[model samples]
Target: MRRPAHLTQGRYAPPVPRRTLDVTSADGSRLYAEVHGPEGAPTVVLSHGWTCSTAFWAPVVRDLADTHQVVLYDQRGHGRSPAVPPAGHSTRALADDLVAVLEQTLAPGERAVIGGHSMGGMTIMAAAERPELRARAAAALLCSTGSADLASEARVFPLPTPGGRRQAHRRLLGSRAPLGPVSPPAKWALRYATLGAGASAEQIEACARIVHACPPGVRFRWGHVLYELQLTRSVSRLEVPTAVLVGTADRLTPVVHARRLASVLPQCVGLTELPGLGHMTPIEDPDAVAGRLRDLVRDHLATAPAPRGERPARQKKEKTA
Candidate 1:
């Protein structure tokens, strides 16, 4: 794992100590990823949502490391990756970055089971639209994300009215108060506001620290894109089998959105709706998410016929040469 040099001297640092793997972006920008578990096992790539880094997936990573290879990266413009000059920050660009990581770290010709939480899921869906990535994927886990036109599905802070959304975006973009590396107070606010809403005091405090330690610029700029973003169109073209996992209580990406995605996806197999889980399904219920992911992976692997040895069902009676 490699660490980007910019992160060390930047305004924010990750609250928890994280291992780093150096990777390059589609445009050759240096990117860093935190990798866990054995390298030879089946690979599972974990992607985090907006305003978050790889640390958000720590719980799930811990649970899956023993059985699978887990790779987590801070998306470009977040975590340890250097924020480029607005040149490589679009949804498609982020999708390309994900491919770069897979090509560089994972073995050649290997297909991986990819899971993205929230915006992370959207990134993977966008990646799936790419022919190169779609061909290399064993399966896809779309967790807590939805497709095109999300005005009704997600909550846009400050509202998307005529001036409200733009005002909010300007505030977030220009205000060093929010993006100039979070202060402890700001971190606490974020914890209560997002990550640890109903969690224990200890958990809330821990989350606050993590939130506070995030880079301000990353949070500010990325939050704007996520709030105003939608990915439904790109995902409709995805070629691999997909598993849609949604928490029943998710207010951000509601169950209706998940249902729609499942209905439209060509390869949707497991559409598991967990009771009482919320937007941050992995963080809110790591075990449950892990269980469903494991089951989905196993089911796909088990049901899929072997390519070289097994005959197609229609041609089963034919003799082998």
Candidate 2:
């Protein structure tokens, strides 16, 4: 398999986690999770996209860990997380894993600003209505993801007909082919499909390494799930303040998906469209992604009111008095 130069050189390595643990999901899958920064700080939990690992969020994590307790995790079968059985692959599984991570990582009554990229965003949507999510998530950022019609809307194939494009995307998603080598042509293809025209060598290398590290079988399984995704109801159920971000040139989950999400989300805080960027918005513009996350942490997560079901300890004590 072809690996990126940075993977060997450690140029864009993920920040060392203060602690690492295996979080057991509802179905008994052990997800690899890491926590960074000081305890008791406002928390930010991040989920990565399809065919990507926790390392994919390195740039953003590096920026956030200075002031926020940043949590990063690999999806089942990706990164340090071991491959799960075939039956364990689905949007529902994604939701279950996310809930487990939140439950295992946070202290009681503490909440986080959760950010998901691509498939990770879909995971948030899948868990939107769950009591665990509502209790643990103060705010959310959905990046480069859609609720449905993924294959139909993706611009990966420049075919003339919509049917042709959709068919091509489906085949591509279902393919178990390995990304064999990171040659110049391979990098070019990666850039065309995922990144902006302006992505630097280092950014491309970082993204390439993370993506290529994913096992082909695992990629095929998750890609098939994405191809058939339908989480519109989940998006509607996401009651927390949410922000949407997408690149104008995104081929995977286009700007239209972002627009639809903003329209349907009950409490959408904002939609940010980055011009000329592609599906890999976080890597394409790490500063912008990190800045938006910081804004959400400051404006929403940090000051979010306590859950309606729970009274403050002082208030409860006064009531007893």
Candidate 3:
């Protein structure tokens, strides 16, 4: 997807990557991946959610780049990556593309703390049992995602009857409706459906542009997959030090998902529910998300050296104590 200049400029402007790679997935679809920060530092690979690109991680990357080598990739049919190939959109394809990204970007035998937001989190869970993910994932951060009953549980529309809600949500999920330009009404709808009440105009606009940039066909395909998603078994198989985070006000994937995941994750380190943030956690509260990641790297990846500038106390001290 080609993003407009204003949408990718200013505070959310993507960090200049150290290198960008055109990764080929198992089915021969090309994936776009960018590596940022320093080489040889403790690595962290970030996967953006549905309807987002590497640009979604701009704030988080800006915060983490000083001490961490950050990697960002666009999922199939999103961002600069070519549209989905003939293999079709499925959880398996998500898993395959993630594996392909790791295989291409990481040095052999090198592991990194991996993190995902929303569908990106599902990508990690979907790839839980894969040997490649198992080999290269030192830890994981699951932010605002669910493994099962996603359409049923989502609070986006808040319909009255159970059957009606499910039906309505399904239609909303797989509607193939075109999201027009980021107009004020479009921002209002996006804000109501996806973001928290406290979202600023800038945050809403940034999210609106990204969400609108996604092709309706691509959105429809992924939406259908999510509508029928069944990944509870996979969540149990994500046997790594994993932390789950969610926005209490998230309409898309509520805190219930985070709670369920916390209960099921094999080695859950923590579950954070931000009081008023929404589904766009990375963009809304980049500092908190980035801070949690820093904690994970310090606690789980201390053996791996950081770049020269960052001091140890900076990494360890929650000194605002």
Best by TM-score: 3
lDDT of each: 0.65, 0.86, 0.86
For candidate 1, report its TM-score: 0.77
- Summarize candidate 3's per-residue lDDT along 217-259 as a digit string, tens digits: 8888888888889999999999889999999999899888999
CA lDDT, candidate 3, residue 5: 26
**TM-scores of the models, in the given order?**
0.77, 0.92, 0.93
Model 3 lDDT at residue 94: 94
Q: Which stretches of candidate 1 lie over 4 Å from their true place?
A: 1-19, 156-176, 179-198, 302-321
Question: How are the candidates ranked when ordered by TM-score, highest leading?
Answer: 3, 2, 1
After the best TM-score superposition of candidate 1, give how far the Cα of residue 275 lies from its true spot, in angstroms. 3.0
C-alpha lDDT of residue 87 in model 2: 86
State how far residue 50 of model 2 sits from its true place (Å): 0.3
Candidate 3 Cα outliers beyond 4 Å, as residue runs: 1-6, 85-87, 304-321
- Clashing pairs in model 3, backbone N/Cα/C closer than 3 A: 1-79
Candidate 2, run of 10 with poorest lDDT: 312-321
Error of 3 at 217 (Å): 0.6
- Report the lDDT tens digits of candidate 1 across residue range 27-104: 888778866665455567878887667766767766766656677888887766788776566687778888888887
Worst 10 residues of 1 by lDDT: 312-321
State the TM-score for model 3.
0.93
